[model samples]
Target: MARTGFDIVRSTNNRGGVDDFIPFEATMRAARAAGLPVGDYIDEVMNGTPGATQSTIDRLRALGVFAANPNTVLEIGPGSGRYLEKTLKECDPGRYEIYETAAPWADYLVDTFKVVAQPTSECSLAPTPDGSVDLVHAHKVFNTVTFLSASRYFFEMARVTRPGGRIVFDVMTETCLDAATMHAWATKGGPGHDSYPAAMPRQACVDLFETLGCSLEAGFQAPMGFASTEVLVFGKGS
Candidate 1:
């Protein structure tokens, strides 16, 4: 089968984003060349952390994100569907929707994971109805995108998740920005080459989610390219 992905245009200014297809295309090309899944290539070749994706899944499991047996789930920027595949194994959610701008990766996920790929606006979960999703999440996304974009998506996550539903995502929070980590981020120049090492205030994340009717339930460290990110889990109140 001819797998036609989106056209890859050179990203100007080293600006990295969810919609930028360059990373998606390049990762696929390398993965195919390496005889590995995108996730494996990322884990084995692209970082100081190996087995990063499964580690995140294990942590989420420990946090009870999988305990609810969520019937419906929505993920933002589920590139290559590593987390999506793991989450499906954990709970096998009946209605799994995804919003991804990399057309090829989105199509790959839809085919491989049997997930619904929603039309994406890059910063909103408009296709998902308010209070309809049992679990809404993103992985390794907030750490690369701009601050305003992550903030907008946070509001949208809260909007789509049902009362008592769960929200989970990772960001480069204060915990991830120690002096040594900052040095590594600057010098190591991880996979997110240009627009990366983005940081968000941890307190602000908890405080804003609280106002959005979700309370921070748990947070833990998850590995990104070369360093780590904080995955915050929130539970919506009834």
Candidate 2:
């Protein structure tokens, strides 16, 4: 199928992310070859200090995300499984699932965590029963999708997460899009990137989540490439 401009841009950006993974993968391979535990290797790479998982947990705890002790936890990417390990240890979920688009990562997640892992598209959670999971999350996943797709993904996240549950996700923000590369890519075949078609605006994402019956708890910036990414934590309404 002929790709549209948006498709081309998204494909190219995704390839760039994948290409950048070479170093991370090579480091892991070398660590394993040297007889280092994979978990320790992952920790060295992802969690030297307050990493994404701990940061998320701290925010969620502040937001009362664990008022009832989450029983089911689902992560969209489970990237390196750093957050997955922390979530399992801290949340003590009864059931765990992960949706990973990359086959190698999916296999690694399944093998390591014994979690139900599947290929996902459109951020769908059909493999999980609706309104069942206590926590549905994705890290650095929404940034790659278009604005409209992000909204749809949010709807799916709301649908699968139980009432009063919590959903967490991160996105590239206006700051990230302001970079020359991102700005140029977003402006390709169109006007200015002020509309932020390639990234979500902070207020816009908050409003959308609010309309989806989620109440914003906290929003913060974390590192992503050359720009800072935004992390949003929301509590679903009953």
Candidate 3:
């Protein structure tokens, strides 16, 4: 018998939980229902602001991201435009494109950034043509993508980047596996069943980059209250 959606969710959760599982719609609804400040919450989480927007700005600046200027940048899944704002301020790219699979969030990104975002359905990394971008950035986008799909995405990133361009993204580490478990509870189905495949392990991520002809420039583990997070910098090669 085929497994129901709930069963898939449950099994996936039981096998290993995930962090960064909040669907865009669910977050919007919760914010609306709580009458909580949507923009504030978004700024806090997406921007990495500690107490508020000012702190977020300060932290980003301290990270040296603002010092470097990228010519063109692509951000995958810029939920609520929080990271959108940060990228605009820090990267200061001449042209910016955001890729979002979720329609409402895509619309929200456009409204907030006043920039066009490519429909994820129509675009991909592999067939995107060569040297299309100077930088590719993804935040929490890889956590839900399966290892095989993640491999494809990395190839796409490599295909679009100039020989010297870079790809920057973050992922939840094994240390954050507990968060994955909690996320699994929200899933009702059995293991290995999800909208996307489960995330790849850290070594797997490193290997994927090497396989795609990119070199890991830097990697660091970040603390996210509950789990360990890793931010990686990849430089594309010819």
Candidate 4:
């Protein structure tokens, strides 16, 4: 039998037999019922942050992410393809490749948006060739992983992006740790997942990408679960 989305969700989120993500299938149902896309439902209803997705897209617009006119796009872990949906409207890359861990979600995105799904891995982009993608990005991803996991992905991101391409991703940084936000995260987060809400210094990220032959083009703040993450855009030198 083919694995259902709920099965996939359960498999990954079965810690202590409490899977908060089993509702993923139901969430898609609700999204259809409300005439909203799955991505919209994840942002506006499930995340309880109406318009947050568009807000980040707007910031991307301001930062000239779309204006670069990329033709080949690669996304890391585009769970519901929320940002990918809008990104298609912005650039309509001819080849939209994705590496998503959730099999059901990857199938959904491939069937729904006609994207190319590559073999998935934990910390490597080995299936994608070096300097092949014009734009590579991950959203709401780094925040939930460990420092080393995020760093490994960062290195791969830079390696696969072509010169003049852009690599975009977000991380929970000191900027998101204002006193109130920190208190809320500490108090409300409630027995948090061990690797969550990873923090990487902004300077370190800038320097790492610089050595990889990319220069910081733009950086900005974007909303995450209950706080914020810093989105960094690095342009590879031509």
TM-scores for candidates 1 onward, in order: 0.88, 0.72, 0.67, 0.89
Error of 1 at 197 (Å): 2.1
Backbone clash pairs for candidate 2 read: none
Alpha carbon RMSD to native, model 2? 7.7
Shift of residue 71 alpha carbon in model 3, Å: 1.6
Model 2: residue 63 alpha-carbon error in angstroms:
3.4
lDDT string for model 2 (62-133, tens) is 767666779988887665676777667666787888876655556777887888875476556777788898
User: Whole-model lDDT, candidate 1?
Assistant: 0.83
Judging by TM-score against the true structure, name the best candidate.
4
Task: Rank by lDDT, highest first.
Answer: 1, 4, 2, 3
Those runs of model 3 whose alpha carbons end farther than 4 Å from true positions after fitting are 1-39, 43-66, 175-197
What would the TM-score be for candidate 1 when compared with the true structure? 0.88
Predicted candidate 4 versus true structure: per-residue lDDT over 1-74, tens digit per residue: 12453333433321221223224566677899889888888888878887888888889888888896899999
Instruction: Predict model 2's lDDT versus the native.
Output: 0.67
Q: The CA-based lDDT of model 3 is what?
A: 0.61
Model 2: worst 10 consecutive residues (lDDT sum): 5-14
Worst 10 residues of 4 by lDDT: 13-22
